[model samples]
Target chain A: MRLAAIALFALAIISALGACSKPPASERFLQDPQALKRGKGLFIGTCGAYCHSTRKDNRDAPYLFDCEWRHGGSDTEIFNTISTGVSNTRMVGFAGKLPDGEDDIWKIVAFLRASREPCG
Target chain B: MEATVETAVDMGSELALPEIPTHWTNARPIGHSRGPVADADLRAGPSAGQWLLYGGNYENYRLSPLETLNPATAPTLQVAWAFPTGTSGQFEVSPVVYDGIMYASSSYNRLFALDARTGELYWRYDHALPGDLRLCCGPMNRGVGIHGDTVLMATLDAHLLALNRLSGEILWDAEIADYQAGFSATSAPFILKNMAIIGIAGGEYGVRGFFDAYDVATGKRLWRHYTVPAAGEPGVETWAGTSYENSGAPAWTSGAYDAESDTLFWTTGNPSPDWNGDDRAGDNLYSNSLLALDPQTGERKWHFQFTPHDVWDYDGNTQVFLVDIEHEGQPVKAIVQANRNGFFYILDRNTGAFLRATPYVEQLNWASIDATGRPVVNPSAVPLEEPEFRVCPGNMGGMNGAWSGALDPELGLAFIPAIESCQHLQKGISVYADGQPFLGGTPLITDAEEDTAYGHISAIDVATGEVRWRYRDHDPLGAGTLAAVGGIVISGTQDGHAIALNSATGELLWKFRVGGGVRSQPIAFELDGTAYVAIGAGNWTSMAAYQGGTTNIPEGGNLFVFKLPAGS
Candidate 1:
């Protein structure tokens, strides 16, 4: 029992040494270029041009760059808005329609987060 | 004919009939002779000081006969009065004035009757909108149709209500379609002798489109003709598999009714999913086409398709103007329209035969017109599943059907309020459901900054489809036009101005900033020997959202009526 506890303690210390090492599986999708491309296609197809658009600021829908959220701009909040639509607007929730169901929303959030980079 | 009132107090004439006490209560009722004008009277065009038809006589000639406010004196015109509606919703009201009163409608299905001379409120009716109802487009109510003592209104929840002209009470409410299944109504119903007809909206939500005719007295739905055929119908083979069930072909705009022949002319919207037609192959018949139908029996007479298998969402649902212009040195009856597929077509109204198709916009590169007036699509401009396709004159069209343009019969010119834009369209897989958005592809739509898109009002000659003159604006012009007497073409601009241009030459004569984008249709009339022009400056439609958003147009909710200041 003591050895098991010592092993867990060592693993915990290793995780603490590099805080980013214990990231969620969904968080890693932000760096994967292929995953970002797929997420972009999904966003452009499903959400773009309905109310919001991907091009510059020529649409009635507020531009979705640089993190200005009408509800909340956090990663989790975006996931929620994408998973469950924003009320009183044309935005509809995408639950089963996405390629990977609910998991695709996390990829979209990551893709949008990375889009803020200069020429991502 | 001008309005007469007790203005100067009649001090000298004791022979003027003495006022009888309590006389109004016992006044004899005037028979139907002098009641609200009939549809036949409207078809003949309203006299000066009267606006009978929605588009000024079924020709869709939004022109007026009054010319009291001339171009030379228009600069001295000032605001006669300003009427305000409390709601800030979308205002597409093209008001009708008759019997010394003007009628208009606003968003959320509200109607207003105002005194034409003083702009005073007469009556207002608010349709009780249901909470569960949802609209795919912006909430807008085009102007109402008035016939006899009844005013016909098509509601946002897909119901047609006939109300009394004097009071604000509903006479009857006819449910046209089910709102739960993504069906709504926005356009004004065309009022006839004993029946009122209207079309269906929500084409983006996969609603199978149709238009129904209701009995004027009891509000009973007489007949409904579907724009898309059923599985076993004649046009079902055009749609593969079960795609015909959800194929979008909404007839959502006001139609022109020819009372003499009892034939009706209208247009249809795009097919679903909007940007992707891979699932449903073949030419989707009747969707992007001009259809002629019999209003009495609801039978299809004939149809002329503008865009066969329209994957670009260019709806051919604009106004069908019946023009009696020369064709091959012979006077022929023609139906002219600026099609959303980037071609201006003049077709034979009687047989639906194509006469001519000309390009009105400069950046239209998607298709070319053949000798038979059919569009020859370019393969390179067609969108694909992966790579983005750049198409000129995007899905918003070189011109939209939101407010049909005006026609000048004397000048033989059709003023087209046009836009210049391009889009990057891409196709993808779309899921179909009962009451959900069904656009199956992605599109980046805009008046593209890279191409420097702008707006223009081009006057196209009706005989030949050639643009005679062009009036250019900095922003894209998207409102309706009014061609009146004295060689003036009055039109609203994206910069919130009601401008009057010389009809023969494209000279800017008079302009006034109404403090908001004037996307509403303009109308002119005469009252007390003075001519006045009125326009509602509020546009929350897609064009306004696209142009007004970028132009920083102020929020607008007022209706302005202008005339020559006291003594010009």
Candidate 2:
């Protein structure tokens, strides 16, 4: 009887944890094998060396995976900034420049955001 | 009965002068009393006995009324003394002295209090600065302010600090703005009754700019007025969209205050993406504007936009001179601005009403005059392709190197250091990622042979809106004007020469060859009844980089004090 009670408590805890978990996305484009591969290629080609690459010397531009950004770090803010350039300094808007359009910009933003997240 | 009489005497003594409060120690309030009028020329000794306020009595004419140096006897102007700042950085700040104590700032963030008579350092204050902080411009502090016993100064890292005049201890320190976004302070703090006002620099680095005032005693932020209004604000519609949020409107230079009107007048720099306006369209209200705000509340009373939709980086950073002038036979409070866009603007000080706008320099192709006396900029001037677009007065305009210009009340003329150069901007489409975007434009070199294309000095008649006279030089560098008592105008140049020019004719009166380039404004003062002129000369990095030329001139950061031979 004692062993049965203990088993029931463990079962109840597991059920509650399962219920609290997030639901699966209706659509997950980032998980697509081709899209993820293409996204990585584009990020490396355009922004990989400049933003992702770290230098032993003084930093001219900030690192992408760094804890702080001179402007902002949120996913939406980064996406918007990337699409629309900052004024004055050399941040130009890429609204019509990208081949894949807004979708490509969004992909890059998602990758950057995910890279900043801690291990789950 | 005797004790009661003694108590009455003590009460009488208490009412006599009212013991100065503890907070009132460093406060030196110069009451707003009208001093003598400074003359246009500096040929002789300062007029009578008036030394007046910093920059000589509120008008900021910077002209002394003394006439001690004569052009005929030019050789008489000799080095009176040399005060070593004891630092390696360039010294761009002019020293302000009161009661025989001189206050000045060195390039590397050191403040010195020196004895006026002997060039002896009384005390020094070094505000600790961070190592990794990037300084877009050089580390320069213009000067310090003296109110009571307090010396107020702004740090390059955007901090306003008040120091005890007797000792070099910091009384209070307050941050002006965030440094990460490229915001910094280089202007000297102007101290008024219980308030210290300061402006920020960083138009080049794409920072949102504004000016703020703080409580003189406690360093409490009193009010902040943004040069560029945000979304839902009054000037939001002027911007095409949300780009106005980060528009660059730096107030890098000091402002002038009118005591009677209780108004502070300052100029703002150009809009962000400095050379391009494709994304952020419309006039971009208040970016390149002269703003008048209430000193107490920091509320905008009126604004006058000098350059609408400025794409040439034409900052209205020239000193705004507040003068009461007779216009059309009527007394009018007017403000005159020697604009960086190669133009002279005179406006009604009270209402921000347009009075007159005229070209102060020789060459300009970007704009023409409209019905409202505004520059109707040609859209072609905007960079669309990589073709070398010829634009005048180049990036550096009518007045560039330093804050040039002095109000000559004697002649009612504004003496300005004018440049006569043109630049070719190569514009093309550039990619934007996480780093600095290549904003499709670069400064192109066209004619390196024409050295005179870089600078000149001109005196403009404020009433007639005409250039009375001009002195041109082949060197690309020149200093701000200092008008003195007689009829002399003292100015310096990058060629390592400080000259006293005839204020009326622009003829060279007296010239002294300093060791290095004279970038600082020469200031004249009387100590122990002896008239002296002090200036700093040194090679700066910005000037060297912009000129794209090597300077063989020895770098000099020492202050040279000059005076007329004994017994004028």
The candidate scoring highest on TM-score is 1
lDDT of each: 0.76, 0.66
Worst 10 residues of 1 chain A by lDDT: A19-28
Q: Could you tell me every candidate's TM-score relative to the true structure? A: 0.87, 0.74
Each model's chain A TM-score: 0.71, 0.60
Best by lDDT: 1
Please give, for residues B163-255, the per-residue lDDT of candidate 1 as tens digits. 777665568888888886778898878776677889998777778989898888788889898999997899999998998889889988878
Question: Each candidate's interface RMSD, rounded to one decimal?
Answer: 3.2, 10.8
Error of 2 at A64 (Å): 24
Indicate the residue-level lDDT of B563 in model 2.
77
lDDT tens per residue, model 2, B432-495: 3222322224333332223335566888888657899988766654467788756678777766
The DockQ values of the predictions, listed in order, are: 0.18, 0.04
